[model samples]
Target chain A: MRRYLRIWRIFFTHSLIQDLEYRLNWWLNAFNTLLFLGSSALVLWVVFTQADAIGGWTFDQALTLLGVYLLIEGVTVVFLVPNLNRVPQYVRKGELDYLLLKPIAARFIVSTRYASVWWVPQLGLALAVILVGMARQGTLTAGHLGLLALMLVAAIGTLYAVWFALTTTAFWFVKVDNVSELFTAFFAAGRFPVSAYPGWVRALLTFVVPVAFLTTVPAEAAAGTLTWGWALAAVGVAALLLALSQALWRYALANYTSASS
Target chain B: MRWRPRASLGDVIRVDGLRKVYRVHEKEAGLRGSIRAFVDRRYRDVVAVDDVTFGVAPGEVVGFLGPNGAGKTTTLKVLSGLLHPSGGTVRVAGFEPRRREGAFLRGITLVMGQKQQLSWDLAAVDSFLVNQAVYEIPDAVYRERLGELTEMLSLDGLLRKQVRKLSLGERMKCELAAALLHRPDVLFLDEPTIGLDVTMQQQVRRFVADYNARHGATVVLTSHYMADVTALARRILVIDHGRLVFDGDLSALVEARAPEKRLRLSLSERVDRADLAALGRVHAAEGLEIELGVPRADVARVAAAALARLPVVDVAIEDVPVEDIVADLFAQGRAARAADAVRAAHEAGAAAGGRG
Candidate 1:
């Protein structure tokens, strides 16, 4: 495990250096990330102006939920998206052969290979938003902060497992480039409170795709509204999905015929 | 560096009845076929490797020669644990390749000429560091190995340059360095010198030979460039139609497939084409130059006859090239298969006639 972490660290450092090499592109990417967050915040401001409360939450609560969404998006962009997006290409080009030959697990290598450290600033922006929203709501307590941190970790784990499982299908369906787009489409629903959606849509977001756990439940923890049952369920779901995704990754690898065969 | 296999071991790599069949989707080439395929998909099984078996002794460099789709890459992939074999078994360095244990991976590396393991945007050294961590090499060993590899491949400034910015040959050298950072005892190189200039090709060939000589590593290389095979591999394995058609020393393969040498004579005067033919099989005849294909056993007699008959100024006897010999070997394999089919048909006809 330590060896794998060391490998990930090396890969991450390489990505950081590579990103820094393109100074102009690096700044441009940073600008674009801020532009995206600014635009999203603008949308949130307009929505709150139109209504005082969204789905039983005040303006600060909705902003906190948006912050959670941004945080998850930042993590996904930093680690999961960049790596998973390359799976189809790797499968088509047979470049995955090198990963398979490595002494470490292929999944671990592929998932952590090309981290987008350029997104680090975006993650910092998300943290700023979360802190500001918490400060505005006057809900910044130690207990709430601890719970929020735990739920955030669980959410990130669940999100990574979901992305991994989706990308693992690339071994069989080599042209599944749109799979991440599908995830993004569902993730957009997490920008608002899960309670804002109708019953069936809420259930779909909560259980089927679990975008609620990624955003709304973590936001609830931040708001000091999360129940013990839901927090326990979040941890259990994260563990279950992680194991499932790992198993699926193995099964997909077994079916890998490798390119040029 | 930690564990060296005894040199007296019979074979570092062994295979038995290995086979890999790929199920490829077969789609017809039209709008109608595409529409129909959307509703019902069809697949065809391609036999990439068929009951192929070969072995390589310790410290030996074996060349794998095959036409495209003849299973050279597939066999290498299977042997390197990239793809699982559909049938039979493969053992490399006394470990089943499919198992892909840490020790097994630590002992072997596969380099594909068309594919690269280096990170495109980073310096080659960064990728090397990644490999260092993946292979779990000690810091001291990693630095020592990197220093030696840098010196050997002349990768002084190249390590700091981004891989995408490097020249093809430079990138290839770095690829070799990255794959060798662990100093694996077994190397599987598939077209390691493809798309290289003659100089770079020679350099790569020399590097492979030098690395093998230094480390006593068992190397299996596949290449379209016979120069690579001739310069590095003494024993060549030729695969045709997913089967090992020829496996022997380079000279032995040449002798088996083409048991004749070319006798080129720059005659003092123009010699008749018929006279050249009478001497041996006339390969080419120009104004004052004559070339004859003489049987290996009759080379002396043919040369003596040629000198006695024609006014020969200079004579030279050269063996057939390894490329032509391999092409002829493939042709012979095809002819033999065709003959077998014909014989089978004739026997079936005879049996049916006898029953009738």
Candidate 2:
């Protein structure tokens, strides 16, 4: 475990350095994230303008949920998409050969091989938004903070699990741009809390794509209203997805035909 | 019949009847074809490696010389476990490569000059560090190995530059260093000095020779450059159309596959092409000079006949150039493949009682 952690650190730092290689790129990405975040907040503002609350979520609770969505987005963009999204390209170009040759797990290397630092500004802004919402509510506690951290792990794990499983399928399909795009559209549903939608839509958000685990659970934890049942469900879903994805990745490796060189 | 390096008991590498067939999707031109392909794709099986078998003893540097798409790279990939063969068995460093066990991975390294393992936007050293961590090398040992490679590869000033910014030769040197940091017992280098300046190629050649000598690592290298093979490997494997056509000592290859010898005669006068054609294939007829392409076994007989009959003043016999022989070897392989196709077609016609 320690060895894997050490290798991950090495990969992480180098990837960050690579992302910073172009000075303008870092600034541009940061600016792009902030603009997207601003547009998202505007949508929230317009939603609240029509009514005091939607589906029982207070303005503060909804704001915290949006912040959680942004936080997860920044984390995945920085650490997950750059790697998982390129699995097809790696398989196409035969780069997976070198990765597979490594003594460690190829999945581990591919997952942690790159991480961008451009998400820093977006993550900082997200933290500010979440804290502001919590301050307005004045109900956050040490226990609640601990629960939020746990929820954050579960959220990131769930996100990585689904993306990795879908991406690993590229080994067989080799192209799934439209499918992934549709997934992105589904993920964008997280910007609003599950409570904001009707019963069926909430079910889709909570169970089908699990945008609820990504945002609502963490947001609820930050809001100090997360129930034991929801937290258990979130953790269970994350673990199950992780196990399934890892198995798929291994099966894909065994069937991997290195691109004709 | 073709020669195969016999597989010994303790050989570091052994391959027997190895084959790989690629299933390629075929599509026709035009929108109609595209839509048809979407509904029902046509597939073809390309035999990339066909019944190739060879073995390498520990510490032997073997050259895999073949024409493009002749299965040298494919065979290398199969040996390294990056690919699974469609038929037969292979054992590299005492492990079945397709399994890619940790011990097997740790025992071998593959370097392809056309591709890179380094991060494009990061310094070469960063990639090395990643390799170091992943390979689980102790810090002190990693430093010592890096220091040695730095000196031997003249990698002193090259490690810190971004991989994309480095010159090809510099990047190649760094690649060699990165690949060898783990001190693998076997090395698979596919065109390690391709596309470099002659001087750099020589340097790479020298480094590979040195590495093999120092560490006693078994090496399997492939290149179009005969000079690369001649300088580094004593034994050469000539593969064509996914089959091992020739495998033996360098001198033995020259002795066996060379098409013909040149018989040069300084005659008292220019001989008629007719007269020389009777003796052998007429190559050239100049003033008081004649050259004939005499079969290797008939060089002496043809020379003696020329000396006895023609107004011959001087005579000499020379072997055909090695380069021409190599080119002819590939031509022969192509001709053989064509002949096989023709024979197959004839048998098919005979069975079907002729068509067209």
- Each candidate's DockQ score against the native complex? 0.69, 0.60
- Give lDDT tens digits, candidate 2, residues A9-48: 8877876676666789878877887788788778878988
In terms of lDDT, model 2 sits at 0.87
lDDT, residue B345, model 1:
100
Error of 2 at A179 (Å): 4.9
Candidate 2 docking class = medium
Instruction: Kindly state the fnat score of candidate 2.
Output: 0.66
Worst 10 residues of 1 chain A by lDDT: A252-261
Q: Give per-residue CA lDDT, model 1, range B23-68, as digits (tens).
A: 8777889999998888899988888889877778999999999888
DockQ of 2: 0.60
Candidate 2 segments exceeding 4 Å error: A21-50, A178-180, A258-261, B1-5, B259-319, B354-356
lDDT of model 2, residue B11:
91
True contacts kept of each: 0.85, 0.66
| Residue range with the least summed lDDT across 10 consecutive positions in model 2 chain B | B1-10
